[model samples]
Target: MIGVGKIKQYSNVLDKPLSKGKQEVSLSAFAFLFSELVQYNQTQVDNIAELERRLEDAGYAVGARVLELLCHRDKGNRRETRLLGILSFVHSTVWKVLFGKVADSLEKGTEHEDEYMISEKELLVNRFISIPKDMGTFNCGAFVAGIVRGVLDGAGFPAVVTAHFVPVEGQHRPRTTILIKFAEEVLRREARLG
Candidate 1:
């Protein structure tokens, strides 16, 4: 397998250890790279949702692999089995490892029992993105939502995760919220486990 940063190759994929996704990449640099991804995807699709889906698909795979590697490396192969425990893991552990900070909040949805939201004041992926009028509600945060979905799905919790930008009363920019709605079976399983 070919390694990305150091250009090392391994006979077997497992021969090379998976490193943390964390890097010293600057915000502007990463933004440019992500923009390239968006631009390339834009050329492949005709609509904003399709573009977001393509980006999310990319992120889902990444989130799954990140979950596997990080959990194994940091948590010693054990995984979260409960809903709240897994939510906490994603909100605090995953965010910290990938973005260098914990999410601003992980709140249970007031109207729904199986719904949860992860809010970030300045999600790294969305920091430098400026939405044009044509795109409407398109957000690069969809990729991050894909990541969260991948992590949750990998951990045995199937959820419908989507990214949305919410307006803050006095803030210059809106906050990014990742909404997670777990499947009924998953919620039932959690109840049984509890």
Candidate 2:
């Protein structure tokens, strides 16, 4: 067994409650941190896919914690049981908390009943990022996709979330669309309860 060194305990920090009032974080700070995260991940991977996967993994962990904290603070420690209800909560409440505003649009897939899309004109995480031309099919929104997946999974609605860039003719840049595909079991459960 390895001997453990004396560690300073900060139990009071854990005991403190999260503030219910609107708390804001500096956008510049977030941007710098995200930039560092991308740079660090990029160095560890050879391809765009691997780099994106690393970012998603990091975001997933953050999402899980954020979901729990938000639910506890705002939902009276209750989880949304309905599919549409959860989606609406994420679209409005979660989006506001994360980005200081709601998403541009939320729509269901025309071809698939279990698929949903949340469109954002500009994803906050991708604001200051500039992808190189060599990195084919790279969108920093993949991190947000992982966050969505983590939240849904934590709330018992397991789903796959992917980020896609859909260009709008008049827009300055392509919009980021988060495509969510709920699991079969989740849909079945929703149907049974609904």
Choose the strongest candidate by TM-score: 2
Q: Local error of candidate 2 at 24, Å?
A: 1.1
Measured over all alpha carbons after superposition, the RMSD of each candidate to the real structure, in angstroms, is 5.3, 7.9
Candidate 2 — what's its lDDT? 0.88
**Please, what's the RMSD in Å of model 2?**
7.9
For residues 1-194, what per-residue lDDT tens digits would candidate 2 score against the true structure?
A: 22567544458986556567656899999999988888899899998888878888887887788789889989879988899988988898888888899999999999999999999988999888777888767999999998888888899999988888899998878899999999999999998987
Model 1: lowest-lDDT 10 consecutive positions: 16-25
lDDT of 1 by residue, 131-174 (tens): 99888998899999999999999999999999999999999999
Q: Please provide TM-scores, in order, for all candidate models, with all chains considered together.
A: 0.87, 0.88
Candidate 1, lDDT over the whole model: 0.91
- Per-residue lDDT, model 1, residue 139, is 85
lDDT of each: 0.91, 0.88
lDDT of model 2 at position 129: 79
